[model samples]
Target chain A: MAAEIKAPAYRQFSIAPAIQPGSMADTKTFVANEKIQEAIGFPPALVDDWHDRAIAKMGELLSKYRSFKVYMDACVHCGACSDKCHYFIGTADPKNMPVARQDLMRSVYRRYFTIPGKLFPKLVGARDLTREVLDEWYNYFHQCSECRRCSVFCPYGIDTAEITMAAREILNSIGYGQKYSNEIIGKVHKIGNNLGLPGPALTDTLEGLEEDVKEATGIDVRFPIDVKGAEVLLITPSADFFAEPHIDSLIGYAKVFHAAGISWTLSSKASEAGNFGMFIGNYQQLREIAMRVREAALDLGVKRVVVGECGHAWRVAYSFWNTLTGVGSGAADPYAMQLQKQLDHRYKQPMHICEVTWDLIERKVIRLDKEANDKHIITYHDSCNVARGSGMGDVFGGQFDIPRNIIRAAANNYVEMAEGTTREQTFCCGGGGGLLTDDLLDLRVKGALPRMEALHNVTETHGVNFMATICAICKAQFTKVLPYYGFDRRTVGGVHQLVSNAIRLGDK
Target chain B: MTMTTLFAALFYLAALLFSVGLIYRIRDYARTPAPLVIPTTPAPRTVGGVAMRMAREVFFFESLFKGNLWTWAFGWLFHVGLALVLLRHLRYFIDPVWDWVIFIQPFGIYAGLVMVAGLAGLWARRIFVDRVRFISTPSDHLMLALIIAIALSGLFMKFVSHTDVIAVKNFFIGLLHFNLQALPSDGILYAHLSMIATLMIIFPFSKLLHAPGLFFSPSRNQADNSRDKRHLSAWAAKLESGK
Candidate 1:
């Protein structure tokens, strides 16, 4: 299936392609089946009255989220963001343009809600919510990674990600959830993680990782789990247990803990830090998923919570975890206030693992032999969610600088990708926002064109051999699509993977 | 009714619709709940920082400057020129026009030309740019056409077929006091005033709401201090309170 889809060729310099209408109109993700939809509390199938239900859902969202209502009204169709989308640049699909993609639902919004669209639909481009429009919403909205790159460029900061999430939420309400995100959300709810690994399997995976690190470095680097009263509760993506590159970062986290002599344990109950409810724009589900972490934190009586390397997971953990579950300060509700009281006030609540590692490196709590990673030349890929959605170290742009600072501290050679493609302006990894399933491999490969081009340039100029990122999805997506573009799949790995290579295991 | 009375009635209706509609829309935006902190990052960490950022966006079109040079240039030119032209029009309503308004009269006359040029550039992109043309609806085009026509008609009155300036000023000043006064019956002047009225009537209904909407955009206006502060909306707080 991957072979059937060709990757976009790497361009010498980045340039937006001319608009090609309907170029990717046929590329749609698989719709969730009844069991998957119902597992996550969505309707089992498309309701007979889906049109009215969808419109009503949209009305509810418009009043609920200011981002939705304001974005729907604020756009002037300036085309500034038309070429900012990677999918548009890669596939040249005009509909892939951020503004055009938004118009899909905005048109429906105007038809039902606005005066001009109601009285003169043709003049304002409003359309009825037909079956065809819903399908189009599914196809194109899923194509977006919810990366927020276009938001940075828009004059009024019109974020299409907000619209996409709201559209997905409305779709799920009308019983039209995507198979990948819905399935995973169900798994996270029921099985404690997206991979659906049971407790015993997770324990076995950790035990195996402990042995692997011990054998490789002749040091006892323990991967502890579910130890009550541990100082820190680490919530990482389950991909860390089940996947390569991700597992290496897992190993890196263990080594860092071993070196620092800190008591940190992973919880089987709240094993995953990611919340797909954010992807679907379901507030109830988002709060529910986050409540597991609150439960685990309260149950274990841990003072601090540290999230591992996952883009959207960090976004949820850093941005929404406070309001949803009181993982941060200033909690007002009963549950949030309880959790907030239990957490240590001195440390950042629900800190990023990079923040943890960087703090250790800065204070010399753990030492990294810079020459230990001499074999690799590294460039950091700023994960979209982390870059644009969250921060670190209590400073603006800390998310950007801290990881690169870690890479520089660990390795001798560190180069950056193109300027525009770094920091807040970074491109999506193509497989973010729940489009990482095998069904959307073609879209994934196409959407990765911009980042791949930037990476290709760094490789030529600086001989950069490895691209390190702090996102589980970016690692997984790049590992899969790198080879399609004639680069080694092994070239992409985690930021801590480099740290793992360089960190001194025993005797500080 | 005479053209004067017809226009007087139209202007009164337009003023009412514009003010009431704009107020209603602004209130709707302000009342809507922002349940989470979703400011695009590298965002300001303080309220003051966010204000500065918003000021830059509103005054300089900072994000648009980051986006595309052509669009930013034309958009900024059009908006800035429109502000000047509107400010200069204060001379019509004020019996004793402010010294600043009098000082800007010449610049305002020239600003009409600049506004139309900017609007023309924006309109050309809508027509010529494939990506833009794909997204442009008939209303988008007609919105531009309407504004450009308004600007051109104003310029026509100023430089080509001049109207009775003192009489126009007296008429508007009289209207401000709710006293009926005969408006200048010049064709270009009537066309210009009618289009301005049309724009005012549609101001709240059309994309022109983007003006006030920009202030309410959470992504642009919110501070990136989510970790330091927990923000919950009234409706979301209800969920937690189990109400």
Candidate 2:
């Protein structure tokens, strides 16, 4: 089903394509079956009263999330964010425009919530929530990656991602949920990871990785899991255990911990760092998913919780874990205070692996032989969640700088992509926000256009052979979609993968 | 009913609706719980820094400036000019116009021209730009038209069809003091005042709520110190307690 779709070509400049109305209207993702929905505590199937239920969910969201409430009223339709969305830029679908994507739900919001729409609907572009509109919501809201790129450009900080989250939440409440996000979330709840890898399998994979690393470097670097009293509990995405490029990053983290001599262990209980509850925008589920990590930390008695190279996982860990599960300080609740007292107050709780690696490099605790990566000229792809949604170190924009600093220290030659396509303005890898499943491979390939263009630019200008990122989704998405765009699958990898290539393993 | 009495009644009603409606909407926004810290980073980590960020967004249209130059130029000009024109209009309500208001009288007259020109550019973009045109509803166009119409008519009274300025001032002062004063009988003057009344009455209900909504927007106004300060909302706190 995905093969027939072709990749968009790179132009001389990143220009906005002419509006193609309904170009992507038929591009719908797979819907959650009754079982998948039921697993996640959503309605098993579309309810008879879905129309009313959807509206009620939206009202609940408006009162609960200020982002949803203010964004609904703040948009002036000035089109400042029209061309900012990668999906819109890639597909040229008018509805893919952040403002238009927002209007699908906004129109319904106006009809039900606002006075002007109640009095005169057409004039304000408000419409009743018919089944057709619900289907439209399902199709278009899934099309969004919730990357928050448009929010950066909007005059009022009108985050279309917030609207997308709310729309998905409302859809799920009424028994219309996307299969990819719901299924993974259910897996996280049931088996502690998205890949559903159990404790034995996780242990086997780590032992295998340790053997592979020892064979290469002749050093006894360990991939310890479920080890109680470890100083740090490393919670990473399950992709690292099973997938290419991501596995290489997992190697990097282990080597960093070994060279620095910091006692760290992976927890099978919280094996997965990626949380799809965020993608579906269900706070209860989001908190519930985060609680697994808390449980792991408490049971293991780890002093610090560190997250690995996954974008949204970092966001959930860094920005949300503190509030969601008391991973950080300042929580007055009993559960939070208990966890807080156990954690080392000196270190940032639930720290990014990049922060840990960079701190080691800065302190000269870990030495790197940069010439080991001499064959590859690297560029960093700022993961959308990390770039726009979360921070790394104490400094503002440490998320951007820390990753690049690691790359520069680990690899001698590094180049940045075009200005706007890097840093806070970076494009999404398109497979983020729960669109990483194979069923949406066509949309994934199409949405990769903007970032692919930026990469192509650097390849042409600098002969850049490697694109380093700090996201499992980015690495996975780019690996699969790079071939479609005439680039090598190996072109995209993790920042730690480069660090793994260059870091001095023993007695550094 | 006399023209003076009819306009007086309309202005009072418009004022009442604008004040009450705006207060109600602002209160609703203030009361709503923001469950999590979702500030668009690299955001400021301090409250003062957030205030500075908001100030830049309000005064300089910082995000829009980052977004599109054409939109920012026109939008900023319109807002600044409208502010000057609004301040100038304070001369009507004040018994003895302040020294600064008297000082900026000529600039205020010129600002009216600037405001309309800026609105014209924005309206033209709405009509011409494909993406903008696609997103714009009739209300968007009408919102632009309404403001532009008010600006144009106000400009017309100053430059083209001259009205009795002293009598107009006296009429506004009379309305404030609960006394009736004769309004100047001019077509442009009536058009200008009534359009303003219409704008005020619709301000709280329409997308003009962006003015207050911007202040409440979590992404812009929030400090990015979520790690240091645990921000647990009431509903979310209940969930924790329940657990």
lDDT of each residue in A1-508, candidate 1, tens digit only:
3358989777655778888788888888999999999888899989999999999999999989999999999899999999899889889999999999999999999999999999999999999999999889988999998999999999999999999999999999999999999999999988999999999999999999878888899988889999999999999999999798899999999888888989999999999988889998899999999999989999999999999999998999888988887779876667677888888989998899899999999999999999998989999999999999999997779999999999999999999898899999999999999889889999999999999999888899999999999999999999999999889999999988988999997775
Report the lDDT of model 2 for residue B67.
97
CAPRI verdict on model 1? high
Model 1: share of native contacts present?
0.88
In angstroms, the error of model 1 at B132 is: 0.6
Q: Per-residue lDDT tens digits of candidate 2, residues A33-80?
A: 999999989999999999888888889898888889989998999999
Real contacts recovered, all predictions: 0.88, 0.86
- Name the DockQ score for candidate 2: 0.88
**Global Cα RMSD, each model:** 1.2, 1.0
Which candidate achieves the best lDDT against the true structure? 2
Model 1 regions more than 4 Å off: A1-3
In angstroms, the error of model 2 at A304 is 0.5
Per-prediction DockQ scores?
0.87, 0.88
Query: Who wins the DockQ comparison?
Result: 2
